[model samples]
Target: MEDTNHKQSKFQRVLDFIERFGNKLPHPFLIFVYLAAIIIIISAIVASFDISVTHPGTGEEVVAKSLLSGEGLLFALETMLENFTGFAPLGLVLTMMLGIGVAQGVGLFDTAIKLTIEKAPRAVITYAIAFVAVMGNIASDAAAVIVPPLAAMVFYSLGRHPVAGIAAGFAGAVGGFTANLLIAGTDALLAGITTEAARAIDQDMLITPIDNYFFMATSVFLIVLLVGLVTEKVIEPRLGKYDPKYAEEGILAQKQEKVGRIEIKALRNSMIAALVYIGVILALIWPETSVLRGEGGVLVPSPFLSNIVPIIFVFFIVVSVTYGISAKTIKKSGDIPVFMASAVKDMAPYIVLVFAIAQFIAYFNWTNLSTIIAVNSADYLQSVNFVGLPLIIIFILVMGMLNQFITSGSAQWALMAPVFVPMFMLLDFHPAFTQLAYRIGDSSTALLTPLNPYLIMVLGFMKRYDKRSGLGSIISTMIPYTIALMVGWILLMIVWFLLDLPIGPGINIRLDG
Candidate 1:
């Protein structure tokens, strides 16, 4: 007991230092503004040096375009408003909250939680939550917004630490984001970029979104086990026991009505409505003649997949409204608009943060520094002649470290793929293999990065439990999972390399192309 207390005290000091350091920095919005300004200055300096890379596809010279130039300045002024509006997460979050807010306001989520916990075995609840969070990647942005709070409610109902629940959910939703049992929106997005990069070298190279499906599916189990172990053994224990006496006012005193006949009926009706919505979706896409199908009768690049965000919004709204009416929590249609207004109101801070982040991303792209770094780094790696498993391991490490600053998986890949994918193909490695390696690195350290919007979003969730919780607390809690995932993923890559395993459907470790 004494030793444990001593260790915890030391850890607390470290957390305190981290919190102070992070707190000393500007707000997330201001940080982005500063980054944008820095990019402009750096762009002008780099552009003067006459640095450029040859586009492998067209042999065109890709030069760094300085944001300080007249054309660049005009572009920035023209696109400033468009950048914020065009930012993907902004719309996704706003629309999702509209649907989720109705359910949340009507107390459907609470009743549902009570029902789920009453039947689920305590021993596997942690694993189950983590698994569902991992699978929620199929819904894109929906998982990030919905899972953490739901998990926290579950833990609170079970007399466990809410922070631990949110942490586990965060780990699954964001940390294990790259690995899923089903093909996710990210898969299609990255695969398209990879194809563009690969075609730069070999026009005949073909890659599908499912290029890493087998490996990613296998990895879901590993993530579940690893996250479950960390949550139960490390996080929960560190949090110690949950005491109702010390919990927030009304948090425990607000008596939850046990799942009764009325609540049960509401749940049943909501589930049926949800099933119907799903059926309608399936009916739309079941035949090649369906409008949802993309060109050549394929699902990839389909309208259905591209429009999944709105589908999620509609699904949640329909189910929640059904439950609210059945449960008598919603007495009128006016209540829904109220819920939507409240939901967006809660997202005010996020809106402010997104504006600055959007500008920063746009400025970075305008500067072309990311592309230059990726190309130069890949060329340097090639010049070193590092090959085989060692090269694979180092590549993962470098990518993982870079993830701390560049949190966008597709953006990072867009920069690196044109260089690494073709270079790897020249080394007799397959594009799919290289893509998988990049995915592994991109995901392993995502939760540790402050630049990740989801991490910031989860911090807001965490504060509901501990008012003092900050970026440091969240990052410290997640460090174990990040390290474990990185090491485990790297080892998996090594095993795949040694066994000469196919990473996906007919995709081997190396290809002649």
Candidate 2:
């Protein structure tokens, strides 16, 4: 027992160190501010060296330009406002959030989550929680807040370990964050950043939100299976039987609110509205003579794809408003704007962070630093002959490690996409493929990070059942899921690579091919 206690103490010390380090880091907003200043200084230093690289696509000599130079200062002063307003992700995220905000405000997301798990068979309860949690990401961060507590209630009612349910829900909500069956705000946000980055190499390149649709859609099932398996087979068994004595007073007596008839009616009406919306879209794009079709009637890169964000916005408005009216959440048309405004209000922090990131990316591009770094990095990789699956895996691993400290996927990608997307493009890999790889890495370690706010939230929920629960207890329980997901996702990527399958509509794995 002494030896076991000693080993556990050492493990706890390591976790404590990681938490301290992560906590010492500044907010993501401040990090970007610091990065913007550092890049300005670095650009001046590199420009003084007169170093340059030949752009692989255009064969043009790209030299680093100093932000301190007169021309650079003028450009920065002139483009500061344009950089923030014209940041691709700014409008995309806000537009999608408007619709999502309505859906959440109307209780559509909460009702759907309850209906999914409350109706599940006892045998598949674990799987249901995992599935709903993974799919719930379509509702955005609200899922992270809503799923775990409800899942724990469901688990406790069924005589299972409530902490196990929390783990499953958190694992699916965060660890499987990037894998969803439908195109979500994350798709638009990430694609916008990727498009901005890819333009560093191919100025005309535009990455659509659906660029990784096929891969992400397929990954949903894999994540659900892995999360369910880890929860039932490993986590539950390790947790053993739940003892009510460990639970806080009155906690066990508290019951989850059952889905009422009004919610069910609202969900049904919303589904009908969603189906009608989709049917109208299909009718508009189904015919060769349809206006939504491309120049040659191609669906990909067509009017339908180009206008996907608007379509998503309108669809959400229609369905959510329908549900809101049916559920009495919206008494008047004026209430719609109120909900939309509230959503944007929640995005205030994101808006501020985007301002910082936009300036950083704009400065990086103006200085030609992105192109210079990408070209030389691509050259070095080629020199070492690291140009295939091995290189892709290494990149994914690097992203996973970075995610430990930088928990925000968009922030990390915004920082990384500028450099890595173009480098891979030079290596003849598609920007979509690089983005897909980044998602795999970014998501696989999400639950393992001490910096993840949702992880701490889950820890708090766990302590209600076992007051002794701490960060170490939650982290240790999550380790199995994290390892299984990372390995499983990497293997899935290997298969996708070997198959050379189209990741999305008309998006290939390799650029030249």
Candidate 3:
């Protein structure tokens, strides 16, 4: 027991140091602002030396442009507004949120979660919560806030360790964040940033939101199994028997809310609506002569691919409205627009962040620094013969470490995709593949990072179960999930790579083999 306490003390110290260091860092928006300024300064210095590289695709001599010069200043002044408005992710995220906002606002998502958990059989309650949590990414970050507390309540009612339930829900909701059975808002957000980055190498390249669908869809099962196993086999056993003395007064007496008939009816109606909507979409795209089909009836580079964002918007709107009507959450048609507006209002911070990111990306592209860095880095990797699984594993590990401090997936990808996407492309890896690898690393480490706000939220839930719980307790419980996820996820990626499977529809792992 002394040795175990010693190990825990050592771990606590490490977590303390991490939290302190993370607290001292600037906000993500400020980080981008500082980075944009640095890029401008670096552009001037590089241009003064006339440093250049041969463009790998065009074979043209590429020279860096000085953002500090007269012409550069004119360009910046003219493009400021255009950059913000034309930013790829801005519209995609906003549009998707319009539908999602209404669904969440109408209580569709919350009711559905309650309905699923309350109906789960006693024999599979743990697995059910794990599955729902992992699949909840379809509802965006709201899952992080909703799942853990609800899971804890269910566990308490079932005579299980509530803290263990918190761990399981968090492990799936945040740690398995990137793995979803369907294309989510995250897919749109990240794909937009990736398309902009890939432009550095191929100007016409456009990465669709579904480019990583197959890989992510498959990962959902892997994450469900991993989270369930850790929760029951590792975390629950470690937590031992629940002690009422450690819990807050009266908390142990609280009962889980039973799912009502109205909620059941609403969920059933909404599910049926969702199926009909999917059927309509398939009917539109399944025929050889369908307007959604490509010239040769191919799905790739087709109207279906290009129109996925709008499809997501309409689908959510349909399903949510059905539930809203049945649940009496939306008494009038006007409520739909109000819900969408509220959703966009919630995205105000993201909108502001995008402004800074747009300028940084525009500046990076205008200066040709992205191209220069990518080409040179690609050449170096090739020269060392480190251009395969070994290189891919290293990239995933580096991303996992980076995720510890920079917790926002979009922000980190915005900063990284410009360089890594094109660099990997030069090494014969597809942009989609690079994005897939990044998601694996990013998701696996999300719960382990003290910087993730959701972890603190989970800590709050833990304290309700055990008043003595601290950040170290939450971190220790999550450590097993993070390690297991990283290893399992990375191994999954390796197996996918070795099997030479497509990550998405018509999206190969390599540009050419």
Q: Model 3, poorest ten-residue lDDT window?
A: 251-260
Q: lDDT tens digits, residues 139-238, model 1?
A: 5555667777777878887888988989998898888898887555566656655765665456677666667888999999999898999999999999
Q: Per-prediction TM-score, please?
A: 0.67, 0.98, 0.97
Over the stretch 380-462, how does candidate 2's per-residue lDDT look in tens digits?
A: 99999999999999999999998988889999999999999999999999999999999999998988888888888888899
Instruction: Give candidate 1's whole-model lDDT.
Output: 0.77
Colliding pairs, model 2? none
Compared with the true structure, model 2 gives a TM-score of 0.98
Model 1's C-alpha root-mean-square deviation from the true structure amounts to: 6.6
Model 1, residue 344: displacement in angstroms? Answer: 2.0
Tens digit of lDDT per residue, candidate 3, span 460-503? 98998899998888988999999999999999999999999999
Q: lDDT: which candidate is best?
A: 2
Ranking by TM-score: 2, 3, 1
Please state the error at residue 120 of candidate 2 in Å: 1.1
Looking at model 1, the pairs that clash are: none
Q: Which regions of candidate 2 deviate over 4 angstroms?
A: 1-7
- Model 2's alpha-carbon lDDT is 0.91
Q: List CA RMSD, all candidates.
A: 6.6, 1.2, 1.4
After superposition, candidate 1 runs with Cα above 4 Å error = 1-14, 122-221, 230-257, 385-513
Identify the runs in model 3 with alpha carbons over 4 angstroms from their true place: 1-7
- For model 3, which pairs clash? none
